[model samples]
Target: MTNPPEKTPENPWGPQNSSPEQPFGQQPVQGQPAADPYGQPQYGQPQQPAADPYGQPQYGQPQQPAADPYGQPQYGQPAAQDPNAMANPYAQQGNGQPGYGQMAYGPTPALTSWIKRVGSHLIDWAPITIINRITDPMIGGYDYASKTERVGTNPTLGFILLVVGFAWFIWNMVFKDGKTGVSLGRQVLGIQLVNADTGQPVGAGKAFLRQIAHILDTISCLIGYLFPLWDSRRQTFADKICNTLVIDTK
Candidate 1:
């Protein structure tokens, strides 16, 4: 009999087949990952986080604030004003005049006294009053007149004077005063009629409207004309309605 083959132990799992390239005793199963001995990441897997070499902020670290995108003023800096902003109508002025709004020219003039205003009005109406007195006999007289005395002796002359007076009032009060900010009476009294807000003349149309507004004074028992005595702005109802002022030009 040939020398008996040396006795050898058989692998319990499978037949032993080892190679120099595969240091382990057997090859890994197909489609299964190989075990790593040094805990290194395998191919196709995500990498672990590493230290920042450039000293930049990393995830979960504090960061510096960014610059303002709008270039707004920083802390302790004065804020800039908007050029298109509207002016305040009620703003007080340094010279003690209450502001009506923005005026392109300058500060408003001082207000005239009630006495001066009244005197100026009287001066303006003097011519009409005298003409009315002179023409009284040409128009219908009072009911108390004797029957022998005829009323309205010359209606033509009375009508003529009436037209003249009305024309005179319109020319002086509306046209002249509106254009120049003064009538003959206002000029003599050192007063002026002007827009309260602008310190400028009110045009002829507005002056005519102001005369119509005076009807309020008449209907209110003439108390509107006297409003200047107690009113803070020294304005009559007509003046208030027209946004006008009687100011001292002197």
Candidate 2:
């Protein structure tokens, strides 16, 4: 019946053979450049610069070599490469809290300071505790009053005691090793002088420096001793300048 009205071929083979469901000449989504070489999208607006690990840029992207806008470490350099970077970014170091190092918190109160002060009035008792046998003969034999009293007797006795005590103070401070390396008063209080860096006994050279500074400490009649109450490190001005600490031995 008229060659079945010019039938199409049973095989699919031409542009006319294509399915109308999909359009021609379009790329599959997998082939399009949806991401940059570093796996970030080239956003619609102008792309801001970014750094790559190897300090080079992917094609079509600007190179940011040195630093980021945030100013942290860039591409391949260590943050600590500069020595200043290792310094504490915060200013509150050694503030009696846990610092980065192993320096523990400083000495705490054993007894109330007034108790120590009252007890200090009787500190002449301590030399007896140091040695069971008397090193000085007069300490053991209590012959109560000498012929010369300070009030009614020889002025020479007072002068001799003053001169000898001052001389002994100078001599001992110039050559000793311990907390009281600087003073008998500090020693009787169960303290020891130590270096700021090493926290161990310092030498005579440093002690001399402290002794010179003691002029300032003594000029005001030991008003300087009250400094540790207000100072952040619990140090007097002399202790600060001499780079020392007075630690408790008790």
Per lDDT, the best of the predicted structures is 1
lDDT of each: 0.85, 0.56
In model 1, the Cα lDDT at residue 242 comes to: 96
- Ten contiguous residues minimizing lDDT sum, candidate 2: 132-141
Q: Which residue pairs in model 1 clash with each other? A: none
Candidate 2 lDDT over 160-237, as tens digits, reads 544565555445665664333434554567656677777667787778787678677668787666676666666667
Could you tell me every candidate's TM-score relative to the true structure?
Answer: 0.56, 0.35
Off by over 4 Å in 1: 1-107, 141-150
Q: For each predicted model, how many residue pairs clash, with residues at least 3 apart or on different chains?
A: 0, 2
TM-score of 1: 0.56
